[model samples]
Target: MRFDQELIASMVAPNSRVLDIGCGDGSLIGHLSQEKGCDAQGLELDMKAVTQSVAHGLPVMHGDADAMLADYPDDTFDYVVLQRTLQAVEHPRDVLRHMLRIGRSALVSFPNFGHWRLRWHLLRTGRMPMTSVWPTPWYETANIHPCTIYDFFALCEEDGYEVCRWMVVNGNRQSRLAGCSPHLANLFGEQGLFLLRRRTR
Candidate 1:
């Protein structure tokens, strides 16, 4: 599992039902089912990844997050997870709405576009920044809506979603700024992970 997947797995309760969106190769799904005792399933757009996961005896289906998420009835799973796929989705807000509607909570992780390194690189080179995380060139990348930590918070607020928990991590090391304000996290964090729920009246 990737670093974000580990953190997401830690957040999910044992024996809960989970739906992992864009679940590449079903690594997290396997981990969640075998280790956490959760009923984990996955939806992936890549046919090759779907085949690989199915070959491993994992319950993963080929599906698109933007189109297929709305087909599920409300609260069908305990959790809906979208790891590192938010920016690539066509309608991120709609995807998030569907996710929260179909599950008790949502787990989201994405690269932070407001990281200082990116800012510095853009300022220094006056071109699209390339790093280990955002390595793809602008013309070739699927990330149409790169966003910051503060931007995510604003979106959650606008949609009446409660941020249950959030953290910032770089590589394998968790940033101390995760406990601090979003300003700090936005400036320093490489990626942001958030656990969110609908704001109940």
Candidate 2:
């Protein structure tokens, strides 16, 4: 099956053991296992997704991301990925800490709320702007923290981690522009992917 979750796909290391937080249907993990030679496991909350993952012969557990990571031994894998789970989560900071503690690196992504179109929608139309990547109605969107890309960086700084790589894809990477044009860029190119490593004294 084809997949579009670039945020997850870009950071996963070939032949490394991986634990995907909120790994819906195990699509990315399956690809990593087959194509990249990685050993993959998934942590998913949806039972349907868990079933689908199992049927595909991928290892998965039916559990919450915030709750499940606590049980794993510290730094147990090459990567502990939290793709698009930060916004939907109730405690983003604590969740991030645990993710950092449990793995050498992390792959994290979220819809950037500070995109120009979202700004325009709020400034002119006074509503949460829904785009292709984030096609949620204002009331129905699961993005509790609807944060900007900068906000994410600031959090990483505060938590003593740093973004090692970043890629912004608006359907394609060829369309990306220089920093924060607010007019020339695609807002729906809303996804931000980063590889993070924790800093130590």
Candidate 3:
């Protein structure tokens, strides 16, 4: 399993239901079901990935995150997870809202655009920055709405979502940065992971 997937799985409670959105190859769900004893399933947009997941005896459905999320009833799962795919989605705000509506909590992880390396690269080159986390060329990348950690916090505050937990990790070092201020995290962290819930009135 990927480092981010392991972190997401750790956040989930044992034996709880989980829906993994954009679950490529269903690896996370498979691990969750077998290791954590959870009722885990996946919804993937890629047909090849869906086929591969099903072939592995995983319960994965071919579906789009933006369109298919609303089909689920309220509180249908314990967690709705979208990892490394938030920036690629067309309607991120709506997708997050729906995820929270259908699950008690949501886990989100994305590459941090405001890392100092990206900022320095852009300033030095006066061009679109490319790094290990953002390996694609600008023209070919699917990240239409790249955002920073601060931007995500702002969105959560604006939308009345309670940030239950958050952490930043460096993919190269495989080290986590927790209990740090958001400003520091935004500058140094390569990726951000958050667990959130709808704020109670």
In terms of lDDT, which candidate is stronger, 1 or 3? 1
Compose the digit string of candidate 3's lDDT tens values, residues 144-175. 88999999999999999999999887873434
lDDT per residue, candidate 1, 34-139, as tens digits? 9999999999999999999999999999999999999999999999999999999999999999999999999999999999999999999999999998989999
| lDDT values, one for every candidate | 0.95, 0.77, 0.92
- After superposition on all CA atoms, what RMSD does each candidate show versus the true structure? 0.9, 2.7, 1.2
Score candidate 2 by lDDT: 0.77
Question: Which segments of model 1 are wrong by more than 4 Å?
Answer: none
Order of the predicted models by lDDT, top scorer first: 1, 3, 2
Of the candidates shown, which would achieve the greatest lDDT relative to the real structure? 1
Ordered list by TM-score, greatest first: 1, 3, 2
Q: Please, what are the lDDT tens digits per residue for candidate 2 over residues 98-175?
A: 888888888887767777778887899877777776688978878787787777878888888977776664554523
Report the number of backbone clashes for model 1: 0
Worst 10 residues of 1 by lDDT: 172-181
- Clash number by candidate, in order: 0, 0, 0
TM-score of 3: 0.96
Q: TM-scores of all models?
A: 0.97, 0.88, 0.96
